[model samples]
Target: MASPLLRKPSLVHEGDATIVHQLLAQDTGLEYVGFKMIDLKVKARYEETLTDQECCIVALTGRITVSEGEHHFTGIGTRESVFEKKPTDSVFVSGGKQFLLEAVTNATVALCYAPSLQQLPTRWIKAGDVGVERRGKYQNQRMVHNILPDSDPSASSLLVVEVYTEGGHFSSYPPHKHDQDRLPEESFLEETYYHEVEPHTGFVFQRVYTDNRSLDETMSVEHRDVVLVPAGYHPVGVPDGYTSYYLNVMAGPKRIWKFHNDPDHEWILARQ
Candidate 1:
């Protein structure tokens, strides 16, 4: 039997005939985070109104124009491919805001969502505005692009980021969990990982497990697959010869993020 946490890619045609893969939220048992992968052709347009949630639209590849009310952002993408190791353009739309996305070229986008009652101003997050950092060392090394973090007040609850792991590397390692709402100690956040591999045929391994081993599952993730982490210590490992890229969306009752690494594996962090 396949793990319920792993969501395989399936096409759902929207009104504009855009190819969309709905991943998190919507009957997935996740309370906060929701995700969708959209593919659009040149000149294609998709309009939407976020009634009760805030959204971050990430341009994964190619170029696109986003319009919110009277304001329009033209030619808002930079990277031609995610593997280019460059930060791409993104837009943040708060609740009750209506927006339109028009593809300037064939493009792929990620829509990350979190419920919110507060209506914040719409902001275009340029590629240059994204904070890029190289995290970990040696085999655990990975590149991180912070599209929207807790420090950014632009969002009410949504926290978004993307990570790139080299082949034979580990990501989200040392296994951390944020399932408890203990304020400064840890926060209860629901998270979703949308995976994409460099060589489409390659695969990666992700494990979601709790302290008791009651909720434990190791998933063989493929291109465009999404893994949901409702509550657990989650870690990812990339096989040799296959690079792994994942876009993460997280949210909780509190907008802050505080995680606790698994004690058994915490020793790895102390190693020189």
Candidate 2:
């Protein structure tokens, strides 16, 4: 079950004094996934030492240099904003290591974290290096960028991905759920959505609910709003004339991303 903190979203704004805005803390009824958004001003920096969690530093805009132990990764971004419709770069660092980032230009970075004991080598994933799949059809059509997919065995529990939908289109459709431990058919997982809408003034709708109706919420979301999922079938929709983009951080007992679609919407997949 999700705590009240998980049910309510604490938005991080660019003008805020805090450099790091954490969406899920230890008290948020989450065991695996932890999320944060960091903004760095020119010549400014952010640093952390991950003793229990591994993380992926995904660039939302500008360029930054990431230092992990003896290795350094530079020029880690290009797009001016997520609305630019271009895939950005990301750097992954293992647990038990010191992570440092400095902004060469003003930048915003999404931090996806998951608890783990294993340590993987720090690696960079460029925009061109990620696979892009156009999913759904008509208004349901959207783009999916597979990052840290199950195909890679380096990380123990984190699964990262990004989704973008055109104006008036629906994404995260079919209302899928991975809250149970039913393997092969479904996997138990916790997820968090960090959102950004194009034109800055745009908005989206996200619904989190359980089958027995024990938990349910349909939220009106704006730029930089976050949604946390502890156990539920989640779906998202965007209004007309506005594009939608969200970075998803997921973790669970298993690294696989098998989900159960709502039975009512399961038939829609057959039509596609």
Candidate 3:
């Protein structure tokens, strides 16, 4: 049986726009996070008014312009593909704002959302502003790009990031979980993973499981697939000859992120 947490891409036509995947928190039994990936052709525009959620618009590929009220941000993206290993541009839109996205070239954009009542400024995040880090070691190595981390304070509840794992490598490893809301210890965050594989035909494996073994499922994820992490420790492993890339969106009652690694696997961190 197919796991409910594994979401495959389905095209939905919205007037001139084609949404590759649209997921709401309610759809996944989550509380705060929601996601959408839109495909736009050259000169095509998509308009929306965010009534109760703040959004982070991430340009996955090609170039696009975002306009809100009198503010216009033009030519905001650069990379032609997610595998390019370069930081991409993103824009943060506050709640109750009306925004427009127009493609200067054929583009794919990701929208990461979280519920909010605060009306903050709509800010443009340039590609240069993104913080890139190389995380883990040996087989657990991966590249991380922090787009809208909790420390930024620009967002009320959403935390967005991009990760790249090489072939035969592991990511989100040591099997960490943030399902508890024990302040200063662990937080309760619901997350979504939008995955894309290099070469388009390859696949990766992701396991979402709890310590009690009650909610355990391993998924073979392909390009454009999404994995929902409602609760539990989630980790990703890429098979040999296939590189992996994923956009992560997370949200919870609080904006901070504190995680606990599985005690059984935490010993791996001691290895040089």
| The candidate that achieves the highest lDDT relative to the unseen native structure | 3
For model 3 the TM-score comes to: 0.98
lDDT of 1 by residue, 68-154 (tens): 997798988988888998999999999888989999998898999999758788899989999999999889999999999998899
The candidates, ranked best first by TM-score, are 3, 1, 2
Q: What is candidate 3's lDDT per residue for 109-154, written digit by digit as tens?
A: 9999998758788899888989999999999999999999988988
2 or 3: which has the higher TM-score? Answer: 3
Estimate TM-scores for all models. Answer: 0.97, 0.92, 0.98
Considering summed lDDT, which 10 consecutive residues are worst modelled in model 3? 24-33
CA lDDT of every candidate: 0.91, 0.82, 0.93
* Best of the candidates, TM-score: 3
Poorest 10 consecutive residues of model 2 by lDDT? 1-10
Instruction: Candidate 2: list runs displaced more than 4 Å.
Output: 1-17
Clashes of each: 0, 0, 0
